[model samples]
Target: MKLKSGLMGTIAALVMGLGAAQAEGVKVGMITTLSGGGAGLGVDTRDGFLLALKQAGDAGSTVDLVIEDDQQKPDIAVQIADKMIQSDKVDMLTGIVWSNLAMAVVPSATAQGKFYLSTNAAPSQLAGAGCNARYFSVSYQNDNLHEAAGAYAKGAGIGKVFIMAPNYPAGQDSLAGFKRFYDGALAGEVYTQLGQTDYAAEIAQIRASGAEAVFFFLPGGMGIAFMKQYAASGVGIPLIGPAFSLSQDILPAVGDSALGIKNTSSWSPDLHNAANKAFVAGFQAEYGRLPSLYAAQAYDTANLLLSAMAKSDVADADAFRAALAAADFASVRGKFRFGPNQHPVQDIYVREVVKVDGVLTNAIVGTAMTDRADAYADQCKM
Candidate 1:
């Protein structure tokens, strides 16, 4: 009886040790813009990522997230990245909104042998010659939506257009992308100061530019302020932009001013796909609001990580990266795949802002570009 009892005790100890090993999860550091002007985008990213984990239940337990606020500052984001890597010992890093912040963090973090799964902010630089194998953008490249908008404008027979974006890497990419696909004449192209609230001066320029349409990419609070002021200014020239400025995050605040405005995006609330429908419904149920493109991207990033974790341990860098490259998860954006540069190669759609059931939201109006790949893919050696 003593011998049998001792054997059982040894078995029990082994079982407990196995359980502890299984419970060890991958540590992920999320540094995002959670305060100041761009708080909404970061909040949505965090909420959506958490929602996916919540929905996953036990399967999501494989990931442990250390989240921090970057306050929409490049230096702050870099500092948080360092702390996350050195102190928290994160296996991977994700969640940055602005292109400038991404530019500041992604290169160094990936260089340090930490994988970066970008939630947003896919700058052209990273997509091109500067591409790294350890970096993957779960979101569309910065140029994609602008390219879609440009295509939409050309299809709509708008001959002359005025383009404007914040004076940042993304802003530069936005206008450059619009020009890439836009065959129309440019009346004016203005680069506004990043986070500039008042658009009175730009509005005056637009009013005098005689452009048929205006394409702008002012994200977060900057967009909200611009739209409100533009609407009041009565710059009868129709305004168009990407989903960053026209999504559920900004539409409610912009009110009726955003009504009937055509914009480009890779995902919309009305996109009919099993994954997307579930994501939209789940996000609304979880957060009591519709998910924006930022939220959807972050949610997809989380699921991507979960899928990879299911296949291999994060400590095995090569195997984990291979798992991530496979992208064996249902994306909220439906058809998603990484291009050679590790940026998304997906369809872009045009969405119109419409009051849906007494709330402002976006609805898919048309498909702008299909199986669209960024122009910089060939430049990337990786």
Candidate 2:
């Protein structure tokens, strides 16, 4: 579905209205993991953000976006956040691909009174007691998709399941979220080292556990490595996971090994919405590749900021915050709204990896949950 001409006219009017004020343009700082293991995710996210800005027509006139590579290191992310705030004097900060980096950078930036709009990464702490008024996540909470996977497993009557994840905060959350809804016997649960490529040891355990299915949350190269090894191991158990493990950016690298795998996610390239159709077509035309959930969420983040900026000046923090909370923007995802914790409340779907015109990608199979809010929202006072 394309944006209606009326909506396009509205956006044009908003852009034209920006010229009425003599205020300084908004400055935004983005620190994302652009190198190392999961660089593809960050690259897609960056490209999506830029694509949205480009579509806005002369976005540089109203927004100054400064991007930095975190290199998948929390320390580097912290350093970049400091520079963006102290040197660049950015009014807002966004774009972090990993939960660990978000943990290190988001709180401090928000505490310092800078509005932090997270394109990705939804650490549990930020959605609960650590929630801040200045922070907003355009993506699902880290565990939401995992929880949907759990629900899917239950519905599919998978009575015995083995789960694995990288040993980190987000990893732990993945297991917890899965167990919360998966009312079945756990064959086993294991945590591998973060960024560990070899999974022979884990495969041995899975092979012997008599598991009916397997769920894992390894992203980037780790996922590619694990799937390749699993396929080679000839384990007949069906694989299930969150979208991160089999994202479009990583699916091509995984090849047919990832085909027929089922995963849960809040967005898909084929979502039957006007905004999504436009985004997917525009993304392919611009990058010569299909856009992943990471790219779609980042694209939505840019539109969110632009929508808020159209309604309220960034210099007016309270007004801007209120405007954003209103969520007066068209999301590529058909249904999107922010919960009390500033995280999305949307539908999560079960998707199967399939070839569309011989290109490996995900196809929506069924709805796992609808209008789901994060589990930790009640813990948030704001």
On the 0 to 100 scale, the lDDT of residue 22 in model 1 is 41
Per-residue lDDT value at 156 in model 2 = 94
Give per-residue CA lDDT, model 2, range 241-290, as digits (tens): 99999999789878998889999999998899999998999999999999
Cα lDDT, model 2, residue 59: 53
For model 2, the superposed segments whose C-alpha errors exceed 4 Å read: 1-23, 59-61
RMSD in angstroms between candidate 2 and the native structure over all alpha carbons: 6.4
Model 2 gets an lDDT of 0.90
**Superposition TM-score, candidate 1 onto the true structure:** 0.94
> How many clashes show up per model?
0, 1
Q: Which stretches of candidate 1 lie over 4 Å from their true place?
A: 1-24
